[model samples]
Target: MTPYGSFSFFLILAVLLAPTVILGLQGKRFHTYNMVVSIVALGIIFASSLTQAIALIIFTIWQVVLIKAYITYRKKSNANTIFYLAVILSILPLILSKLLPFLSVVNVIGFLGISYLTFKGTQLIIETRDGLIKKNLPLSRLLYFILFFPTISSGPIDRYRRFNKDFELEISGEQYKLLLYDGINKIFRGFLYKYIIGYSINHYFIANLRFIAHSHFEHHLYYMYAYSLYLFFDFAGYSAFAIGVSYIMGIKSPENFNKPFLSRNIKDFWNRWHMSLSFWFRDYVYMRFVFWMTKKKWIKNRNLLSNLGYILLFLLMGVWHGLEIQYIIYGVYHALLMIAYNSFERFNKKRKWWPQNKLTHVVAIIITFHVICFGFYIFSGQLFHKGV
Candidate 1:
């Protein structure tokens, strides 16, 4: 059963969360209960495929061992080689998962949520290397954080420190009630977005458009918009469900979307769209790259460094989606847009040619929206399809 995909899954979730609700309302900590539920839920999620179950088990064990070992070593020394090795090992499974399929090899190591789980592991390793996680975390806490079933598949990628704070909090009954209300509201929104609107667009508009001659420009145009909307609603809806469930369990997983379509620029759109993932890339990948380059004096020109960072960031993001040609093109396409927009912004700042007003803001939003939709079109692989 897919997570958050069916009535049965929701029914089971309700049943499982009943104890959590009761405990929380009584102002009791439900960490142990939640952990148990997470394990059980994971078991159920991977039950249909024994291979995937084994893969998940092995993956979890690998991460646990690696984290513990790294933490132990980190206390004794701060070696750059060791830190890099730990980071590489943390992401190795995800790398293999993405690469093996392209090599026409059966992916024995890949499983659902491998990418997100790898992010969690890699984050822990990085923070440990940076001496942020000074205290030795317990095995149970580590397992619970890594295997938290709510945001397992896709994430608003919670940080270790933030998640631990929530896990250890002792909330009042009044606060619990508020959290419960918010959780239910977000779940309702999820249903409306994913089930009602997203489904309607995919089934009615996108499906019908596919039948009306793919070579037609109008058909492709209609599809681009329909697909862009569908992608947002579907993903945002899933994120809502994940975050809401996290709230009910007393962890406020971060928000992933914030009116992305209304963004006024490419950078602004990224800040508002799949925010957690984009922010993850920005924080972990782009920032690190820039800092390293600066420290090494590899690229002295700030603009040149920033442009290169954008290229690497988007390309890595694209490859993360898959090793498809369209995905790579989509990444390069966005990189160019970002560079162009940055240059234009710098030029306009000096000249003050573009007026700062409601009309300009609206026009920018409109232009940015189209730019994003075209990127989505590339991401959809529709342009690469044979008949198109």
Candidate 2:
């Protein structure tokens, strides 16, 4: 029943698109078809199990109510208590879901899309408080945005304002055709990434690595390289499928990855890899930290403030991955890398002797790729596995 992993899923998706195609071509506007298709798609996903369905329903409703209420009150006065309470209440379900599992507790609140859904809701709440999302949107639209099944599980997280524009658009025949072309192209590419190449790399290389480690096989370090590429293709494949599906439905969702392997440094890699999440953290967390410190006159050194911001950003990123030690280390590793890169750039800025040619860029990319592969090893959590 999950997306992008099964033939049955695509068959179901195609079948579900009947209503959308009909309503879309009738000049009934985007919302008419968009709402219908979104509901049918979400209904299909949520209908598989009662527990997840209930959890998702409860979570969505809770956030909507909280957000709407907060918006109303925020118009009168924006108190810290109200804002924090609303934000905490909004994330309570996801917190419980994430924490309960780590405690060896029965995961009552857990659902497949809970993390992404909660992130969307929390963004809505924070942006609303900041007066960015000013309108008290319709409940149906809000639900559609949160439970937008195309990206419900994992995301190239969409912004409320950006999505609203597409929701309001009525596509021309030319535009619709272009959307179709791009959608199908991305979907085919996703097939290559996830089903073909991704599968081959995983089942052939990574699977064998486990056996090799236990056996007398040598040169086992190749497993790390294989795992890293497999990861890129596998998750990038899923993201491509998700984004492609969104396009077919008329939402130009932001991209997740952008030639990440070609990046020249940790700073450049973050900008390219899992771009939506990175950008989200950058704008909301990292930038905010810098702004807060700058506002309070806490530190006058611009470079120091920026470096500290990177630490805060990556630490939050690590914690968000989970409260695991390896994840924390992964975050610290990137933070330190970014800081060191920043310092290097500052030191090199005064020197006319530093290379500024394609050769230097190529060398930087090579070095950056290895560094990222090592980070991926930590992220893989294999180092901490008891059997390993």
Candidate 3:
């Protein structure tokens, strides 16, 4: 089980009803549910470790600061570089913690949901800064939006605007029942995916590196693909858990994946795989790069620079995975494959003899899957070790 399993979840369930539960007994309308929830959450966080407690405090302050700044900016009809800096400041810990682990003695930087919360919080601030959205949420709703226990771990990475839109509705009986059942189903499904599927494959099917060291290319290649599938199921299972839990809380998070294996090309696979991360990069990084490149007239051909931009973007994507040399190689490897494939497509667009049918699609999928699998070996750091 994950560290924040049953006890943490039931604690949240109790906290969710603290307002009504307390009022029904004592007959008062004090909005002290947040205090109750925060106290319980703080206790759990402290019991878990100091790292989580610090993270919780940081995120709680983050939500408050962003909400205040956004509201103030909206009222004044002005921009604040200070607010943008504050957003960056809030994100700095996630970056340092995730990246600096490669150099640390104690690899103890596991603060659950820090990555997801930072993404969601920064995007909220960005939209607010752009005047594309407003900040009118009440304290309770804003607290719920940011610190809702379900999606706080690994996330489907919902945008602030979509989440905020559904904030006001009362949690109904039917909704609660449906959500609870769905959450339970998701938990079971995630366990199956992680343990039954991933553990079995990792333990037995994939050959050890000692075997690979002496084996032929084909043997190593097959294990590589199996390892890749294990990664997908592991990550996808966690995403399912996050999204399913959100559903039970009466919120619909964006799906984090599609049937990524069915994709016909590298680009298509990225679209299907880690959908939330891909979109976040597109919205925050790629589009901004395109716009800036277009305006500066640095390159006469937009397509040329756009492709280069993608390679650079994926370099950052690689670093986001980790600060290891393997991760950098993984990033560069995919970028080159993507670039070459795109270039090939552009070149073949003029040739009538080039295969462009289902057989061709199947071949591309197989090849791309291999390419991704090779990259996963780099991600693993150690090949086929136990519980990798």
Candidate 4:
């Protein structure tokens, strides 16, 4: 019953989406219907495990109470301690989920999509603390936003305000037609990427690399490239499916990938690859860290602070993936890459040494691509697992 993983799921999805399609094509709002469908879809998704389903319900109730309490408190005052507590409580479940395995405890607090749901809840609390969200959100709307089935598992993490805008939008027939076309197209592309190309690469290429390669170096190198490509297609494919479903339901979930492999620099690559997640870390984590440091007057050198922020952000992102050594190393590796690239860019800017021509751009792309693939290699954990 994995999301976007089977024919039965797709069949169910088509049936559930039928009402949304009918309403959307008629230039009407389908928010209520969509919400009901989301609940049903979530029920089916979690139905495989009764414990997980109970976990989700308990998690949802915790979030709702916390958010309501915070909103009420926020109306009277904006206390730092209370805000911090709210944020921590919002993420406590996810933190526990990540830490429980290390302690040999069964994770009763964990369920599918907890990470993403925490992200949404935490963002809402942060925004409320910042006064961006002045009014208390409706419980139903909050639940809908939290439980939106399409991007619930993994996300092009939608912000509370942004999602609300789409939820409230009234699509015209013309607009709906365009959205319908685009949604279908994206779903088709996802099929090609995931079912066809990604499958072929994994089954035919990556699976056979060990037999074909004569040496450890060749085998690892080929695996790195193949794995990197496989990851892109597989993840990008899932993103497309989620976003496409969102579009059909009139939500317009953000795009997650661009021409990531063609990126000319590490920074450029981050801006393109897994864009939604990168931007989320940039906006909520890195930017906030820099702002807090500046406000506290802890560091005067902006560049030094920025570099530190990158380190913290990536490390958190890595730890978010899991508490694995390879994930941590992957984070540290990317932080170093970003810091090194920033220094190089500054040096090049001062000297006007790096040419910005078509040829150089292509060369840059090649270099950046290899660098990224190597990072993916670290992320894949093969270096530690296989001793390669």
| All candidates in order of lDDT, best leading | 1, 4, 2, 3
State the displacement of the C-alpha of residue 174, model 2, in Å, after optimal TM-score superposition: 1.5
- Clash pairs of candidate 1? none
Candidate lDDT scores, in order, read 0.93, 0.84, 0.69, 0.92
lDDT accuracy of residue 203 in candidate 4: 99
Clashes of 1: 0
lDDT of 2: 0.84
Off by over 4 Å in 2: 22-30, 210-220
Give lDDT tens digits, candidate 2, residues 191-252: 99999999999998777775656552332356667888999999999999999888878888
Q: Which 10-residue window in model 1 sums to the lowest lDDT?
A: 207-216
Which residue ranges in model 4 land beyond 4 Å of their true spot?
none
Candidate 3 lDDT for residue 348: 82
Greater-TM-score candidate between 3 and 4: 4
Per-residue lDDT for 153-234 in model 4, tens only? 7687889899999888878988999999999999889899999999999999998986888998899999999999999999
Evaluation by lDDT, superior candidate among 2 and 3: 2
What TM-score goes with each of the models?
0.98, 0.94, 0.80, 0.98
Top lDDT hit: 1
